[model samples]
Target chain A: MSRINDVGGMEGFGAVPVDNAEQPAFAADWEARVFALNSALLRRGVYNLDEFRDAVERMPPAEYLDASYYERWFAAITTLLDERGVLPRADLDG
Target chain B: MSADHGDGALAARVRRAETLLEERGVVDGAELDAILDRYLATGSPANGARVVARAWTDAGFRDRLLADANAAVTELGFRAGGLQPTLLRAVANTAEVHNVVVCTLCSCYPIALLGPSPSWYKSEAYRSRVVRDPRSVLAEFGLTLPDTVRVEVWDASAETRYLVVPRRPDGTDHLDDDKLAALVTRNGLIGTAAV
Candidate 1:
């Protein structure tokens, strides 16, 4: 199992005690639609990106299986977006 | 502290919204959920298995599906109507070559059979690369359809959708429905591999 440094995401997740936001360390295409969705989830507090990040930090190398992991991430983010007014209630709760 | 992380509740919410729109004749909720959940759990749709099975069993049905997948599929029993309707045509694979589907515009997948799209399919990299050079892309996924194999790429824009009608693998003729279904993996539909 690789440590947080080996996998290369712990620092990016508001973990690893980042010294600056300017040099944002992120995974590929974080500015894309889905990543935006994840950030929105965290900002809106629908779920805990912090906790999720913590989980990621602790995860072994093999846990990042197919799209399911990413799907779960998207689900968490979308749930928050729906909870907030940014996305309509019907668009989420319907 | 929260109630969303437990299942695919977030995606369910998105699907729920789509369903409401569908109710007002904007989209098809049944079709949307059937498509979405396939990706949520199985990474593919059950209809993929159904299509593959039928293609192997009946030549006439195979011909019909290849000509017009939506119509032939409807004959077998699956809803094929909606507001922004999609017409699914099949691309058959032969010994000489194979066919694969990718929506260059977006990930316009066959929602009728395959539910929601996995993250990889929707990525700009996959959408852009699959059409221009499928052999290289498929190779990255550990699949290489031979040069002899005619690699016809269907551009699945928002207008028309497509699905890969994978050839039945050898030693599968005697297998029953369940066994055959098990063989139809998501990668096979993407023309990345055979079961």
Candidate 2:
């Protein structure tokens, strides 16, 4: 069989990693649930449609970080959602 | 049902209050403090642990998960994205190795499923580092690889959402769903740890 367990005695184990804090809160359950929710929309084609994808592909890789860069993406996707009828502009802007 | 309506009204009031707070330049920071003091007395969905758990259990479901975790979740109840709910995706960690998840543009989390995110998750440290050298960052988390596993990085933006589902641990096949879920920590769920 393919090698399963690892040096950590965590063989056959699959995961991200652990926290480095004095208190390993291990308290991100709700975070996972909500995260799953948003991605599900994208995978199903409910969030970013073709236009948004094209806009992102065309936009520069954003060599520098700026609030405007964030705004640009938001605008692109919001515009796409309005155009595709997934979300009415009012839902976003208002 | 009355209690449900009451909760809805409370949430609406919170949103209305937050909007007014924003207009006043208060932002989500102060509001979060208040939310913590008041509403989160028991617990809430911002943590992102349980959401990761669901992502680990099933495979056909995992495919559905990465494809569109929201509808999969919405079929149950929670909703997110602006005033209403939207989809949240979770990536799976398999046998051969590394994965890093982040929303490079904005903080699009699986809020309905997970709870408040770790402060680091929302910072430039995670957003910048993961894309640059995922292996190094994973190493910082004590996740060393043997060069056989391929690392996959996913950038979540306001446009898309994602969480990482850690691989199930060894020798725990005997653990049932709930037990298995118990080991699915927040960091593990976020691709920071193996289950």
Q: Which residue pairs show collisions in model 1?
A: B35-B115, B35-B116, B36-B116, B96-B149, B97-B149, B97-B150
TM-score per candidate, chains pooled = 0.55, 0.52
DockQ-based class of model 2? incorrect
Error of 2 at A67 (Å): 13
* A4 Cα displacement, candidate 2 (Å): 44
Every model: Cα RMSD to truth:
14.0, 13.8
lDDT tens digits, residue span B6-51, model 1: 4345445444544444455533434444433343443236667777
Q: How high is the lDDT of residue A92 in model 2?
A: 43
Model 1 segments more than 4 A misplaced: A1-94, B1-44, B81-83
Per-prediction DockQ scores? Answer: 0.05, 0.05
The backbone clash count of each candidate, in order, is 6, 63
- Top model number, TM-score: 1
Name the weakest run of 10 consecutive residues (lDDT summed) in model 2 chain B: B1-10
